[model samples]
Each structure stands twice: as structure tokens, then as C-alpha cells.
Target: MDSRNLIRHKTQVVCIGAGPAGLTASYKLCQNQIPVVILETNPIYVGGISRTVNYKGYLFDIGGHRFFSKSQAVEDFWTEILGDEMLTRPRKSRIFYKNKFFDYPLKAMQALLNLGILESILCVASYIESKLFPPKEIRSFEDWVCKNFGKRLYSIFFKTYTEKVWGMSCDEISADWASQRIKGLSLSKAIINSLISPNANQDRAKVTKSLINSFRYPRKGPGQMWEVTAERIKEMGGKLFMGTHVC
Candidate 1:
């Protein structure tokens, strides 16, 4: 292990983001004896959009991001990196509908009951109308959603928030988003399932269960995890370049 030979044979791996993906890659590479250089634009932080920020001594995230992967390898990797800092948290989500807060993955009976007789009747009517005269091509997201779940349900559950997120009207957006986001979901099925078997293996129900439940969070937030990983990488003869941007 001569110094000259070490300098000559040094392996270099440059990772750009220093986010979860980049940090994980760097960690694995270092584990295999490969030298890594992480370049990040933000000088004060390494985590990307998933980064956590402290405001008035309170840690706040860019959004509600949780670490929950279906892959065991990913889970194991995080557990190894985070150790006891990883905490399992119960999920709490709600939907604001007609100035009322309702549990997300909307309880069908409760939702309909809350909508009242007139609105519920309109929802039923819209569903019946769509069923009788189904759209010819299902061109837009609005059309697809209305056809499947009806106008009232779509307006209540999908319209405003979706518009806010995508910055587009339901008609302007592609059906692909709706199809992928709410695949195999329908108001008729939801109501019937609620009445008959609420716990049936419906695709939407499964997706909802997978989403709103429990998730892992680092003790100080996601930034702490990346900071520790970065430290480990540096300790393993890696170089981290902060405030470096690459176009």
C-alpha cells in the first residue's frame, strides 16, 4: 500500500444528486472499495426534493414524503443505514369535501350520506346516464372519470385537487393519468362493495391500503439519513463536492 501506487490506482465514481438514489449508489460503491465523489448543488443540504428543512426549530418537509418500499432489499438497505433512527409511523390522511373533513380512501356509505339525498340522487343519475350513453372514445381524463365514477363523484373527489396538482383542467389532462392514478376504480363498485363486502380485494382498496397506513421516517427527517450516509462515504475515502452544479 505505497502512497504513489494508491494515488495512481485510485478509483473515482462521480454521483450527481446526493439524494436517496445517489447516496444509495455511493454507499454500495464504497462498500465494494470504489472511491466516490458526490456533487450537489445545494451547499447547506444534500437531499433533493425529499430534503427536510428546519423552521423555527421545527423540522418541516417539502411535502408529506414517507419511506415505504415494497422491495425488501430497499427496506433492508434503509434499515442498515438508518438503524434505530428509522421510525415506523401510523398514517393519517383526510379529505376536505364540501367544507367537511372525511377520512381519505373515502368510506363510500359515509361519503354518500354526507352528500345528502339530493346530491346522492344526482350522483346516481349521472352514473346511470353515463352507463346508458357511454362516451364513444373516452378522450379526456374528465370523460374517463365521469364515465366510470360519474360527474358528482369526480367533481367531489378528483377535480379541484387534481387541477391544483397538474395545473390543468380535467378535460385538458390525458386519461392516462387518471387510468394509472385511479386504475379500476368506480363509484358503482365502491358503493356496492361498501354495502356488500367492504373488505373485498378490490384494486382501489388494495392501493389505498398500501398508501394510507404506516411508513418509515428518519428521526431528524430524510436529510439526517443522507448526512449520515455522506459522512460514511467520506470516511471510506470518498470526496463530496457541495455547491457544484452540472448542466
Candidate 2:
């Protein structure tokens, strides 16, 4: 064996992926004066799904990642990393169906009006039926949603969109996905919250991620956050090896 071909490296910690979590771990380690190395397969990008793509000078996120968390510590960490570079923007999300747009995190009145009288009545009936005869065993996304919002509402609001985005049938997807994504939110809870007075005690921290009205984003893009983080890590004596794949 050629001695020169034999390479050796040593670090207190080795982080993989270089995505938000990996970068964050490396950053913290570097901050504590610990030697760390980050390995990322993509040579040009540091953030995984959180990366911003530059196409003909137009910047767009790869996965539409948002900077919102139920944890204050996570929020504070983002602020600490980006500081003023983070922009607080009011979230405006909509779903387009049947040549019309409907608000996401759906407003009950707006949804009913948009769905029309007959469909609305059917949806209500479905919800009541679900309440009266809940599924004995919840297995998939379809089951969970049908048990909560009912089959009718799920078809309209969830089925098409979810299938299109995920490229899988709702029945094929795990109930865990629905539970996690729609955590702390249900049709009844949504209606109750909407009916509550505007001045009611609604702590922002306690609000679900889906219901968040505003969120912070890096001025340039979410990629900027990781870019800055990588630089900071480098300055703090951490090594980042891009274009490196780990098996």
C-alpha cells in the first residue's frame, strides 16, 4: 500500500448531511471549541430540503420550508444564527380547486360557502356520522382523516391535494403523517378557535405550526441561513467537506 494514499483525519465529532440538523449540531460543537467535520453530498448546496435554488437569478426554495416552531429555544436559535437577516412575513397560503381558491388551515364559513349548500350539508352530515361511528382501528392517513373530518370533507380538501403533493394514495400513507402534520388541529378545534374573540388569550407559542399567521425567513432565503451558519462554523474551526457522500 502506498503510504501517501493512506489518508488520516481526526475530529471530535463528524456530522453528516449538512442539512439544518447536521449543520446546527456542527455549529454548536464548533461554538463549544470542539473539532467537528460536516459531510454533504451536494457540492453546491449545504441545506438539504431547506436549500434555496438559484435559477436564472431567481431564488426559490426547494421545499417551501418555513421558519416557525412551537419551541422558544428553536426560535431563539434561529434568531441567534441569523439575527436581523431574518424577515418576519405574514403567511398567506391558499388551495386552488374547481377554479376557485380556498384558505388553508381552512376557515369553516369560507369553506362551506365555497363548497355550496348541498355539498356543505353533506360534509356536515359526514362529520356527524364520523363522530357517531368512529373507525375501530385507524391505520392510514385516509382512516385518520375520515375518522376526524369525514370522508366527504377529506375528499374535497385533503385527497386531491395530498395525493398530488405526495404522489401516493392517502390509504397508502401512514396515519402518523396526518397526525404529525395536522398536530393540535382538528375541524372542531378550528371552528372553536375561529369563533373565539380576536382579543382572546391566544399565545403565539402555543399555536400549531399550520395555524401560524406569520413566520421568519432569511432575507435572501432559507439557504442564506445555512450559508451563514457554514461560514460561522468554518470561522469557529469546523471543517465542511462538500460533494462528499457517506454510505
Candidate 3:
């Protein structure tokens, strides 16, 4: 073997995939004076699936992935890197159901009122029925959500979009995803929590308080942050090979 190849590498770390997770890891590692190399398979984009794609001056994403971490370290790191370019914007999420739109994270009363009396009555009936005749074991996503929130709500809000995203029937999908994603959330629990503690979702004085109002987004797009970081890495005598595919 060549002497250069035989020599030990001095770099402290090597990270695969230049996506947000990998990039953040590399950034933190380098901050501690450790040499790091980030290997990305895709040459054109450094931000991976979360990266923005520019087409004729219009920006689009593979999917709508918003940055909203409850971690202070994550928030601080993003703010530091992006600086003022990160704008705090309000979240505007909604669910399309039966040719009508409903608030997401479902404010119970509002959702019920919006769903109207007949559907709402059916929803409550289903909930009581499921509770009385609970499945011996929740085996699938549909079964899990239906058992917790009832069939009417699940059919209107979850079934279609989830099927579209996963390309699988809710019955075919495992219940683990539902359990993890909506952990500690139920229609009764939501109503009770909202009534008892109106500010439960507020950004309170406590470090563990939930954030409800706003989120940070890059001025142009998320890709801008990675591009800037790549430039900084190069300025610090690091190598960055854009448009070069690595197997």
C-alpha cells in the first residue's frame, strides 16, 4: 500500500449524509476543535430531503417539514447559524375533510361545532361504543385511533391523509406509529386539559413549557443555511466538493 494510504487519518470524525442531523452533528463536533468530514451522496443538494428545490425562482420541498424542536439547544444552534434570516412565523395547519377544512391539533369544542350536530353525535356514540366494547388488543393504526378517538373522527381526519403518506391502509399499518405520534392525546383528555388548564400549551416560564405561537423559517429557504455553512467550512481550510458524487 502507498505510504499516504497507510498513514493514519488525523480527522476526528466522519459523518455520512449532509442532512440537518448530520450537518448539526458535524457543526457541533467542529466547534469543539475536532476535524470532521461530511459525506453526502447527492451532489446537487446538501440538505437532503429537507432541502429546498428551486425551479424557475419558485421554491418547493419534498414535503412540508417545519423546524420546531422543543429543545433549547436545537433552537439556539439554528438561531446562531441562520441569524436574523430565521423568521418566526405562525403555524397555519388545517385538515381537509369531506370538502371542509378543520383546525388541526383539534380544539375539541370547535371541531365538534364545525363538524355539526349529526356527525358530532355519531362521533360521541362511536367513542362510547368503542369504550364499552374495547378490542382485546389494539393491533393496527386504524384500530388504535378508532379506539381512542372513535370511528367518525378517525375516518374524517386520519384515514385518507395517512394512507396517502404511507401508501398503506390504516388497518395494514402497525399501531406503534399512532401510539408514538399521538402519545397522551385523546379527545376527552384534550377537552379536559383545555378546560382545566387553558395555558397548558403556552410558552411558560418553565423550561419544559410547550411552544404554541410561532416557528422559525429561513428567509429564502432551508437550503440557504447549508450553503452558507458549506462556504464557512471551505473558508476554514476544509474541502467541499459540490456536484461531485460519492458512492
Best by TM-score: 2
Candidate 3 ranges beyond 4 A from true positions: 1-11, 130-144, 163-184, 192-211, 237-247
Residues 1-247 of candidate 1: C-alpha lDDT, one tens digit per residue: 9975586468678899888789889989888788788899888777787788889999887656678775789889889888999999987767887788766556667777888999888888988888888888888899888888777778887788778756789899888777866665556777887788866524454465333467899989888788888888889888888899978
70-128 per-residue lDDT for model 3 (tens digits): 67888887788889998888876777776777766666676787889998899889888
* RMSD over all Cα atoms, model 2: 5.8
- How far in Å is the alpha carbon of 82 misplaced in model 1? 1.2
Order of models, best lDDT first: 2, 1, 3
Local lDDT at 204 for model 3: 30
Better of 2 and 3 by TM-score: 2
Q: Which scores higher on lDDT, 1 or 3?
A: 1
**Clashing residue pairs, backbone N/CA/C < 3 A, model 3:** none
- The number of clashing residue pairs in each candidate reads 0, 0, 0
Clashing pairs in 1: none
Among residues 3 or more apart in sequence or in different chains, the pairs in candidate 2 whose N, CA or C atoms overlap within 3 Å are none
Report the lDDT tens digits of candidate 2 across residue range 34-114: 789899999898888889989999998886667988688989989998999999998887999888799876777678889
Model 2: runs farther than 4 Å from truth?
A: 1-11, 166-173, 192-206
